[model samples]
Every structure is written in C-alpha cells, then in structure tokens.
Target: MDWKGRRQSGNIEDRRGVSPRGGNPFGRGGMRLPSGGMRVSGMSFKTIVFLGVIFLVLKLIGIDPLQILGADPGGVASEQSSPSSPRITEARKDEMTQFVATVLAETEDVWNGIMKSQGLEYPEPTLVLFSGAVRSACGNASAATGPFYCPGDQKLYIDLSFYDELAQRFHASGDFAQAYVLAHEVGHHVQNLIGVLPKFNQMRSSMSQSEVNKMSIRVELQADCFAGIWGHFTAQKGLLESGDLEEALNAAQQIGDDTLQRRTQGYVVPESFNHGTSAQRKEWFARGFDSGRLAACDTFNNPV
Candidate 1:
C-alpha cells in the first residue's frame, strides 16, 4: 500500500502514554499529592518519560494539570507542560500515529462516498490511540482485549504495539494487513451507523450464549466483507499493490477463531466460535471484494 503523502484524519486522539484511568502510570508512591503541592519520589528515567507523555496528553485534551493534581483550578498557577510546552514535539511525530491517521482518512473517504451513493451521510468516527489500557463508553479495556470498535462511543481504540504482534506472532506482516485490521474495526462503525449493530444487540438480549455467539460470527464476517469493500476501492484506485490482497487474507486466516483456538488449546470448539472460521472469513471478504456491493455482504440473511 502506497499510503505516504496521503491525507490523514483529524479525528485521531493520541492518548498513547496516558494511564487507563488518566492518572499516574508509575504505581503508588511514584507520584503524590500533599495538601496543595505535588510531590515526586523515586522516579526512574522511564517514569519521568511517562510523566512527560501524560503531561502532554492532558494538555492536548484540555485538562488543567493543577486540577488533576487536586489543586483548586482558580487558586493554582504554574507553567505546566502543554501542547505549547516544548517537551512534546518528538512524541507527537510518531510514525505509527501518522500511519493510523492515514488509514483512517482512507476509510473516511471510501465510506463517505459509499454512504452518499446510498443517499446517506457517513458520520466519521474517532480513533483513539492508547498504550496499556483505555476507557470508553462501552467499557474499560486492556491491551490484551485487542483493537476494537466501541459502538457506544462511536470510536475505534487501538494499541499500535499490536502491529509488532501481527508480525512476530500472527506472521501477518504488511502495510495492507495493518490497514485491513483497522478497516475491519471501522467496518463495525459502519454497522453501528446503519442500525445493524442495534438490531443485533436487541436480538442478542433474548438469545442463548451459543446463539449469541453464532450471531456474533455473522457480525464479524460482515465486518470482514466491509473491509474487503474498502480494499476493492483501493485496488480500483491503484493504491493497492500485488500481494496486498494476499496479505489481508493471510491476516484474516491467522486471526480466525478456529486458528487461534487450535494454536492456543490444541483443539477447536465450533459452537464456542464467535468470529467465523478461517475459510469463512476469507470467503466473505472475497465476496465483498468481488461484488463491491453492500448486497453481497448479507451474512445474516444467507449462510456465512
């Protein structure tokens, strides 16, 4: 994928080094609040780095540092680290940050056109980049939960470090593969916007665990198809190179529930599967890519 020099989304929230609860990440005693003063103790170099990152993030989000440290907002006065604060230039220019913003911009462009063609408007979703853990309207999630789209918040959350695991563990390394992952989450956002997610949630309220899991498979497969729709657009625009499709397919296969279960437990339980099998995922994506129509992505009406 030739994504360089491309438009980048302005909806990215770079919360990379902030703690999950928007507090000190260096554990207890690393930072302390004493009456009206902030105290620092036993801070290592890495801890200081994290503090700098947090300070930068808080300012970016417009949260007063003194208020966060338990001081009265009106009574406190200090030269705190902020966006204008000089220490944050390097962190803001991270390569992964640019890559995510670029991919999100592509999704926004493609989906906006797609939705408009159907006489609908696409409300672009925000993408939140975080490290370790983050909170969303849906819930708090750790990095172990993987990248996800929280419909409740209408946002996408990701830990860029997942790219390292995509290469090292999943063995699916390529720019397109990473794009596919991000697009798949954005696909969920599409589902949310179109009422598919709400209907699914309503249906799941009366469903058994197994039945809910089965419905989840359909949802997951449709997102895969939606991602393929994005790929179809990119390919037509000559942005996708040879082997890019293969990389995406390989990623889909590698992350399939069956593949993951077998790799982890040495066996697979079909009924326990939430996402589709490897073959099913690849097939649905191909269906969308080949047809380039939302009608082809009816994973719920037809057998997936």
Candidate 2:
C-alpha cells in the first residue's frame, strides 16, 4: 500500500457536524417535536379525523402537504444541536479523509480506462464522509449501518469510525482492508452504471426473500471481484507491498456474511446471507486479481 503522493479526489462531501432532530440519523429513536406542535400522545380520534380531512383536501387541490402544515421543509426538525463526538482527533480524521480520496481517485482512473476500452463512458461516483448520521436519497443512515452505496444517488456513504470497528471487532485491520470496503461500495456504483441494479430491482417483486438474498450475495461477490480488479491495476502501478494481498484477502474472509453472523449472533444462517461465504468471496476476488478482466466476475452465472 504505497499511497504516498497520490492525487486526492475532490468528490468527497464532508458532513461530519450536521445533526438531525427527533431520532439519530439512522432512524432509531422517535423525533421529539418543538413546543406548540402536535404531540403523538395528545392526538385523539377527533384530532386524527381533522388532520385526515385537511390532508385529503390539500391532496385534492394539488397542494404540497408539508407546506400546508407550516413546517420548515428544508430545516432539521429533530434535536437542535449536540456536542461533537471525540472519537478521532482532527489530524487523524483528515489523514483518513485524504486516504479515502486517494483510493477513490485510483478507482476512478482504473474504471475510466476499463470502460473506455469497452467504448463506454464511466461516470465517477462521489464519496460522502459523515459522522454519527447522514441523510441520503435511500433514507437516513446511522454509522451503525456501516458503509453503503445508494444506487439512487450514485454516491458512497461512509463513517471513518467504522474502520476502527472493523479492526477492533472484526480483526480486519490494515489500510488495505479499509480500502477494500470502499472499493466494494464503489463496485455497487459500477453495477448501477452497468444496469445490473435495475435488473435486480425488477426481480424483487416476483422473487422470494431468500431468492433475493441469494441475488444479493451474487451482487456482493461481484463487487469483491471488482475490488480485486482495482487491486490488480494498483499492483501494476507498483503500489502493493508483499503482504498487501494477504491483508485484503484476510479482510474479504473476515467480513463474509457467515463469518459476521456467527461472530454477532453465535450462529450461521445460510438462506439469510446477502453476502457470500468466506471461501466464495476470497475465490471471486482472487479470480479478478489474477485475470484482471471484468468478464471474469460473472458471479451470477457461476455456482456460489
């Protein structure tokens, strides 16, 4: 992982200090309203009827319901403000921020080159950095949900603190491990760009939950393979150390759905697994790394 003097991406949106009212950004707790507002406990049958009638009339007239309610549509309606959490120092946070930016720039370079070779334009996705919670087109997410890619927005959301948890709880330490997580999310963005996400979404209504979960495992494993493709390019650029590959492979194994479930819940549930097992993830990633070909990542057709 020789990332010194690498170019940093300007696509990072830092929203670490912003807070939401009511509940945490991840939508766990109930939002408390300000004074003079309708309280859930105070609402009676008559009040509910009156509000229902008002909403119906507003809908009939094509009026924006939120505006009719005299609410600040653009402002945070949750808690006012809280003291900032002091997990990482400002200097360390900045360093991690730059590291992510550099990795994103590398992914952009590799994907753009690969896409151009296939006569397709590659649209780079933004990486958003936040703390505590963040609002996304997909919905509100707390740091607890971990890093995720929102296909609707074509952006990656991450909280750097999760890296700490990855190291401490999952024992997946090393800078390369962190890079793999980012690369995996970027892989989802690639799927979105190449139409895989739309096809999967279309099948959701007809597929059972277990079937959909199997599809999700395929999707995740494909991302792992894409991350390995990135690693191949990075290695070609002479950026990899001797043990860097092992670090990444270890990370891939450590975060497998089965491994993670067993660690958290003391049991493994195969049908509920969205991400592939340790061996499948490592194998697909190694396939991509060895072949360095996008076609090698056809997890949908391969047995998992």
Could you estimate the TM-score for every candidate? 0.77, 0.78
lDDT of 1: 0.80
Q: For model 1, name the residue pairs that clash.
A: none
Positional deviation of residue 27's Cα in model 2 after best superposition, in angstroms: 13
- Per-model C-alpha lDDT, please? 0.80, 0.79
- Candidate 2 lDDT, 134-238, residue by residue in tens: 787677866767888877678888878888877777788888888888888888888888988778877777889889788878888898899999999999999
Which stretches of model 1 miss by more than 4 angstroms?
22-93
Clash pairs of candidate 2? 21-78, 21-79, 22-31, 22-78, 22-79, 26-142
Shift in Å, residue 217, candidate 1: 0.2
For candidate 2, report its TM-score.
0.78
TM-score of 1: 0.77
Q: Of the candidates shown, which would achieve the greatest lDDT relative to the real structure?
A: 1
lDDT of 1 by residue, 111-206 (tens): 999999999999999999987677776666666667888777788888777777787778889999999889988998999989888888778768
Point to the candidate with the largest TM-score.
2
